[model samples]
Target chain A: MKTLADLKKIREKAQEEMKLRGGNVRIKIVVGMGTSGIAMGAREVMKTFLEEISNRNLTDVLVTQTGEKGLSSMEPVVDLIEDGKPKVTYGNMTSDKVKKVVVEHIVNGRVVSDYVVATGN
Target chain B: MSLKRIDLLICCGSGCVSSGALKIKERFHEVLQEKGLVNEINIIETGCMGPCDYGPVMVIYPEGIFYKKVTPEDVEEIVSDHFIKGRPVARLMLQDEEEKTFSTQKEVPFYQKQVKVALANCGYIDPESIDEYIATGGYEALGTVLTTMSPQDAIEVIKKSGLRGRGGGGFPTYLKWQMVHDNQAEEKYIICNGDEGDPGAFMDRSLLEGDPHRILEGMMISAFAMGATSGFFYIRAEYPLAIKRIKHAIAQAKELGLMGRSIFGSKFSFDAEVRTGAGAFVCGEETALINSIEGQRGNPTPKPPYPAVQGLWGKPTVVNNVETYGNIPTIFLKGADWFASMGTETSKGTKVFALTGDIRNTGLVEVPMGITLREMIFDVGGGMSGGHKFKAVQLGGPSGGCLTTQHLDVPVDYESLKERGAMMGSGGVIVMNDEKCMVNVAKFFMDFCVDESCGKCSPCRIGLKQMLDILTRIDSGYGKEGDIEELQRLGEAISKLSLCGLGQSAPNPVLSTIRFFREEYESHIRDKSCATKVCLDLMHFHIDKNRCIGCSLCAKKCPVSCISGSRDEKYTINQLPCVKCGNCMDVCPVKAVTKVPGMHPEVAAKRLAETKLSHNYDE
Candidate 1:
């Protein structure tokens, strides 16, 4: 019951995702999924980012997970790696903030300085 | 001219995965694609990178930039700046004790002192992935044994490793293997004792859950050495996660032609199965464990024709605890001398202990044999919680003894611990602070043993109950001068006559406490005083008028309403009405409620001082 076009579409999508790796306007988002981070709601925060990116059709942003290395007092951590700027790590993020990050930071090319862990200050 | 690719390593250890590491991985992919950087970044999930204190952590390679406390919101900036511009995030980096910035994880003090051997693959490899484990040189020893070395050769390698059982008995592992090997039985069995019943212990659970394949590999190697055709993992039903992971690992290994038959096309064929325990504490004993596997009551049986001689279904069997089995593949992989050279001469290799109680870092620790108690408590355990004064440390769970500050210098090995009136009982080290009452602690352990006794032996069943009653009476200010002597006599009798290890070691806590802190017992008996103010009946709560604010908080909160007086004035506790519940003491905002000996403080103090001074003379 399946068509070759569907298979071709799947292959094309995979190829497209593979091809977007080296774009200049790319955005990288890293979420902390360590035990403490997950206990503090990192799962919801991560799902929100994926939903927002897909809904907004933003293809320039990449998301990933990282391990815990101490600082257990604060978890559900997020690190933003923007082009042409210093990386910033944030903590205690929520779903709404993930939306703002996708729209304002990824699409508009502006670092939401308030939520940034390090503004290089 | 060049294409850029960033590798994001995520921790998927239980501690991290439960914190949402998997979702974080998904979010990373979504955000990367949305920002058009999906192709440039490769997200990989790794394992536990110790320093569990700052867990849910990830480190960026190439630059070796370390980040802490990262959330979803911060992910965007990390992507925008670091991966895009290559400028490291300074604020996200870890800070030292002096608040100095540390960019790399190697600079962290918590990691610098640690020498990891048992936990080598804990955080670095994907535990669930077989390829990662194989890439990291897993199962090479099993391959070597099946392909090159004979079963006898494998046994010799184990003997040469000087690997004693890590299950606290200090029994040489290879000897046990050889005993089972020499036994003439057609259906010999090997069992991994995963029923870790010691309180505050999770070393077994973590190893089984984190790296099931390693344990499986070890079991396979052990089976080969002992000529065991089949093995059973006797894990307590309490560890659902460990059971699930191990079952999965076994199934996968079977599918890969490694477990069922003719592994790697060798003449030998072996398989494994899991048997769930009903969570009986006594099942940790080999005899009790074997009995439980037979679908019978888990009661300890007399030894001599031990499990190695006649075991499950009347066949020769070899049994090793979780930590002992975990050390097996490593011994075979690294060779004998490498494993032998790490610890003391008598007890070689590391021992994983669950450091709990008053320690600041309440978690699992694997330290080499012969490490002093002082070093374990201070350097590794991060000292007492809340910086309280260190008083004593109880080793080996209920069957173990408590060591005071005087014994801090004693090296922790099987022989040393036993010589100090304590056995290395499943490696549970519970640190106690100055606030603890040694006598009360002994009573607590005695109570636990009394409840857990299988009642098969009359001496243990009756003697422990009698000792508990005496301890309870002494702690309640009703003990006479002869009670201590009676308890000691009964403890000795029970210890000498008990049938199995469980019954034999039931009185260890009481005996050890009496040997070390006899004055504490004497105070309760001779002076009718609880020095630590733990026994409610032996303490009298009085309000110091100077410190009392007369807020009426104590009077209002008292269940018996024993506290009487006006709010404008000071409060007085009616002695007759006071139930000694300590509710007034807890509710007092100021340090007004003072606990003094019910008899007399000066008399109690004098008696305590006399007893302390005469202790050495008496001994």
Candidate 2:
């Protein structure tokens, strides 16, 4: 707080805390939290995504939950959204699959077609 | 978990707080706790989010969904469906004038047209939290000024920014800073004028309450540039919340070493304290404000030594309005050209207006300079409310003039407004509809001036009272020929000869109405009628035979029992006995009773005959 560097440090730290409020983000990870999705372990998948994103210090990435993306058969579904690109829906998501999705689709920009249930603009 | 999955930004600004926003917040907390989602969800109380007409407003982050008029009862549904179930509540979203729904705060038409410069951190951050202000790039301006720029260089940057005083006068800000900087008084001071007493204006109050830290930073920057060692915030006592928040902000800033000696390890140091005024309208004038702060009666002194030359116990000082200081940090943070790029030729950057009256979206708006009144009223303000048509707009409070429909297209800048007979006083824009009587409007502002006049100079004390007398008789149906002319003469004399700003501009409301709405005055004087029926003395209530449908409701409701007729025939009001209280007009179920301007036909005829007989006798 005494010097210029201290302010910059606090700003950087606070900006991370304030990131979710921002409209513009590099990536958004949406997990379906409908009753069916939660019954099928969507909560575990969502937590795993948050853990991975936070562990890697992904400041520009956000993890949010939405109700009923409607494909109950693909319960525990997750959607990877990036600006100017089609939203990629990963079906039958699990704690095991969240890591691969974060690494391939999020960190490396390689869509995992094996788990892809849908691609929408 | 550094970040909550959902953030509920509930507006706790004074406007929203009065509408039960705090209760809504408590209900949300209780519901969230019951639902076991308290940790994942965050509820933060922020400042004014504009659109105060539809408060208490809440904005949910991540999705940026905006909910208006939220009640405590609605909290359970919002927490369960929106928070836990992740589905936004659709019914509570904002609807624009066109009946189009808008969910996100950014997409709302009221917000889209606004450019928040002075209000950058107002609704967005928590005012109590200095870290939130810093997170939004707050005191970095002070840091930069203290570390990199010399005092002269800092003043030059402000001069280049083209930020004129937002307080009303449109005086170039850097000139004041330079004058204070040049004066080598060891105990020079800076004062933030928060004594905003304009009717229908809360722009300064909102800034002080919403972003106290920003104003503090602005004061610090001004102090640094002007070489002032200490400062004072002269806020009116009426704005208790604003005063409390500002005092709290000063304490926090002092705790952080942003205030007091040797700030930021630099040689430059600045500090400030809060002083509350007794809510006198004239104390907003700089000299009067200084006197009030000096514990004297708030009467303005004549200018030879302006506040910049000698102020605050005869030391060189700078007094800037709260909103004027609100713009300073941004000018330093963003370069001068960046600040200058937004506004008109003479007036630069944006203006924060407390838009009120008949406007649909009544709240605080900070729009770029040169935006037309049409855009401000229709686009940003969401047009007129209650199915009323636009009549005229009162700008700059009692000190400012009214602009009519024809002037709607005029660009709203300092020079343009002044050219059209209105000064851009402290930005209080009161929009009037056709239902408003122009003469009455002028009288209302004049009455305010009469009450608030410090009674220092004869022109203000005696002259303004004379003008108000003319206006009073004109509205009271006792007007005569040449009354309008007499008002004009007195108004001109007062504007020219009054001692302080309060007296000099007190005649503006009357003068401007005379300039733009002269016909309303002529009608009031010659016809003894108010077109809007606002002056009850000048209007008569009568039941229309065509629309009455033999309704006896008017008869029952008339306190004077002047209405006669039954359901078999159309109801008629006995005009002679009617007190013109318009009770019959209010109770008419079939659109029967109407207030017609001037006396009743029978009454007029009787008066005419009596006058003619009197004239014959004189002959």
Candidate 3:
């Protein structure tokens, strides 16, 4: 990936992998690490995302961390950014729920609406 | 990992998150796991999918089944009925008046009507991964240009595309690039302006947060076109997410060898850095943005050299807006003719608008330039929320204009909008319902402008203050007859005599509202009231004797003890003690409370016709 051609080659390989994974299934999991987020068990939720992405061998999934988004009500939250335009924020994410999220959300692409703290842009 | 056949994409836009999308997601997990359908279905969470009002929205793959407003209680029903029985819960889908559901995503009127260009990859790509962006054919245009087209030829392609700045005022993209390119200097710089500062606008933030690679690619293309050594992405500090995404994107681009020295092994070598804004709305303006980027106070200098000749520490710099830069690669990838084909004669390509405020389908919508405001509201926005009649659409934030019902059918091109006293500054169309008072809306924007004013010039500083005072008086029912004329006179002076774009366009909201809804202002001045009942000082709560049951409910709940008379007698409102907070209205179980506004009789009639009053005596 040190050259332009390498960049193109990898992109082509990624496209092939995308086809293997059904072409349109790139997902991002964000764990809130803000003051309220950490106080309300956000660190465990963060660990869950990293563990699950690796365990599942999901090539397209990305796990990131963030601080308090000022919305204190939905603490210990995780935002699932898939496809982009719409971001779904799930609140009070326990370690127990992470497995189910991995199976249904990451694998199945089913939205866990009960925990949806934030919905649109 | 092996993939599942079914995918459930949930909308996680701001509207949906606030609407409890997280709870809905958790409910889906519980139901799916319990039903033993967890392995069979895959759930993916995405960003705002246009119809934010209907969030937490989700679409099931294979069938493209659309669901909206999915509560935790309803998730069980959806999983059972839709996943197990292969029958979608018809109630969850967006339905017409006939109770028929629009099951498919395309069938939903909101998604079908939009033309996604700058947003072509947004809401449909993984923003963090450069691979996903590349797989979607992202950076191919940059690659192709670096290997094939000359810098001069690249500029020519952009010029031919007829692309204009989407930040507002609709400046030509190619001309800016050309100016920087033609300017002889030891060094030149190119930039992506991501400082989105409009009140109700989130288009730029959405673009940056959703698809950062697109913006980076756009900047890279500009760097190649203008022969610049470096570029910067000036994102607002308030948008931490956007800033992070851009930072990630630049790193990824560099790692992939798409950025840094001798890109693609060509002589054209360019790089970019991320510089965050310090929460100033005026930084959206090019000159002010540059100042902010250089660690100076964000202030706009007069533009004669125009940054193209001398900018960014005395170098020719081309600062294309975030949305404007997003269009650069699209024009190069698709032919200029193709990019030019979608929009009107002057305004080419699609424009992304943060469609929100009192509108049903409140989200980011990308539409061709010539689309009508009527279609934006009825078709794209899914009509006004809460059964409120459409009053006006505030375009281009405070610096823009308020377009009324009369301008509904008019094409939303840059020139067309400018002709009607509105400039297509940043495309942020905030829908106003019948309940929204026009004078108050103008005053709100005026207040925003006055607070944000740099105070470098007396015209904007002193002039805007005078206007705000006048509007405040009128709204509070203390307006004199000559206030309207005074506002118009002062508003004109501010627009004319102010320095920079901020001051020059400071009175646009007031000026445009006065132009379209002059009668609303007239009613506020001549009658000493607001017809919309929004101005608290201009209205009084009255006990409707016909509806009052003498339950003493109104008297019991009056925090100010404004109500008089016994339980068996007609309760009268004492004007002296009344704070007008309407606590009596909240506690009255028999529906006795009502309002009497101060406005013209005819204007009151018109307002009543538009507002379907329904008071739920529940706090």
State the C-alpha lDDT per candidate.
Answer: 0.77, 0.88, 0.80
DockQ of 3: 0.11
Q: Which digits, one per residue and each the tens of the lDDT, describe model 3 over residues B207-323?
A: 887788988888888888888989888887888878888899999988877888888788878778889888888888888888888888888888786899888997999888888
What tens digits encode model 1's per-residue C-alpha lDDT throughout A1-121? Answer: 0222332444344333433323333667777766677678876787687667767766666665565635466566788877677777766688877778777777887767666554431
TM-score of 1: 0.76
Best by lDDT: 2
**Candidate 2 error regions (>4 Å):** A23-26, A41-58, A82-88, A94-121, B1-3, B97-99, B546-551, B567-570, B601-619
* Residues B150-221 of candidate 1: C-alpha lDDT, one tens digit per residue: 999999998888888877677889999999999878889999999988776777877787678888988889
DockQ of each: 0.03, 0.52, 0.11
Q: What's the lDDT for residue B170 in model 2?
A: 92
Off by over 4 Å in 1: A1-121, B1-97, B100-105, B579-587, B596-619
Model 3 lDDT at residue A99: 80
Model 3 Cα shift for residue B475 (angstroms): 1.2
* Candidates sorted on TM-score, descending: 2, 3, 1
lDDT for A23 (candidate 3) = 56
DockQ result, candidate 2: 0.52
Best by TM-score: 2
